[model samples]
Target: MDMLHFGGLAVLLALCAMASNMIYNHFYEMVEHHYGWQRTVRMRVVHTLGFEAFFMAIALPLTAWWLSISVVEALLLDVTFSIFFMIYAFCFNWVFDIARHRLAARVVADR
Candidate 1:
């Protein structure tokens, strides 16, 4: 395989991962909020870790074969995904909380 091909595949995979993470984070927040599970942040973290592992295992192997790379290389790519997910989950939730608070306060002031 050409070096450029690998680089292109890597960039494509990263973009897809980012899009999926955004979707998943929104879903996770909805589920947690609807169920009033804020007290179970630890459970959420654990669930996210398991979710990341499950996805990486399946995706990494297929990516490795498609990209003609080693499994280790694929796992390295996936580890990057895992870290992205972990950080995104925490930071998005934090920012979301702040935004929600501001919205609520504005509503109160308007009324």
Candidate 2:
């Protein structure tokens, strides 16, 4: 296929990924609140790291083969995104935990 087709398809795929992630944030918050999984700082850290590694493992080979790029290059890019998301996830989950607790406490107090 032509570069134009490849580029367009990549853009479309990225848009879909963005949409999925947006939807997932709601479920992630719900899981944290319902299960208390991310209530502790330590669990949040581990969860973020595991998430990053999981995404890296899934993305590296598929991206390399599909883009016709070197495996090493794809791995490097994947790692970069993984690291960024790891830190982001940790911070976001931490804040979400605090918010979840406060909201829960408020609800209990109201009743």
Candidate 3:
């Protein structure tokens, strides 16, 4: 496909992924709150894995259909993205949690 088509597809896929992630995260947070789960390294690992698994389930078939490839081929192609995002997710969440906690603490102190 042409660059324009490819770019549009990329944006569409990204939007879909973002929407799915928001939905997944809402449920995951509810589970964590209900279970009183701390955001430890182990929990973060589980979170990352779960998110990727859910996303892959949605993305793999779409990828295969869009690329006219088999699911296996799409999976192979997605492995790199998965790996990158796994690491990215772990670090991003860790940092974000730290920042969030600090901000919350400051807000409480200012009250």
Candidate 4:
């Protein structure tokens, strides 16, 4: 495929991944809230593993169809992507929670 075609496909796949991530986090947060669970180290590990595992289910077929690769190839690609996103999701959520806490503190201080 040409560079343009490949680039477009990459962008589409990224968008799909982002959407999936958002949906997964939303529901995960809902469950956490319902259970009153703290974001402890164990919980974070669980969240990271659960999100990545769930995402693999969604990504495998999409990756295979989008790239026209075999299932084995897709699984390999998804595993690589999972490694990246697993770290990424952990850090992103950590930073986001920190920022949210700071913002909330500032708002309370101003009151």
Each model's C-alpha lDDT?
A: 0.71, 0.69, 0.90, 0.83
Candidate 1 local distance difference test against the native: 0.71
Residues forming the 10-long window of minimal summed lDDT in candidate 1: 38-47
Better of 2 and 4 by lDDT: 4
Candidate order by lDDT, decreasing, is 3, 4, 1, 2
Top candidate on TM-score is: 3
Clashes of each: 0, 0, 0, 0
Model 4 lDDT per residue over 12-46, tens place: 77887788888988999999999999987689889
Give the per-residue lDDT digits (tens) of candidate 1, residues 1-111: 798987887776677666666666677667868988763467656656755765575568778988788999988866776798777865665676678889999999999
Q: Please provide the root mean square deviation of candidate 1 (C-alpha atoms, Å).
A: 3.6
Residue 102 lDDT in candidate 4: 96
The C-alpha stretches of model 2 lying farther than 4 A from their native spots are 1-38
Sort by TM-score, best first. 3, 4, 2, 1
- Candidate number with the higher TM-score (1 or 4): 4
How much lDDT does candidate 4 score?
0.83
For residue 104, model 1's alpha carbon misses the true position, in angstroms, by: 3.2
For candidate 4, what is the total of clashing residue pairs? 0
lDDT of 2: 0.69
* Residue pairs in clash, model 4: none
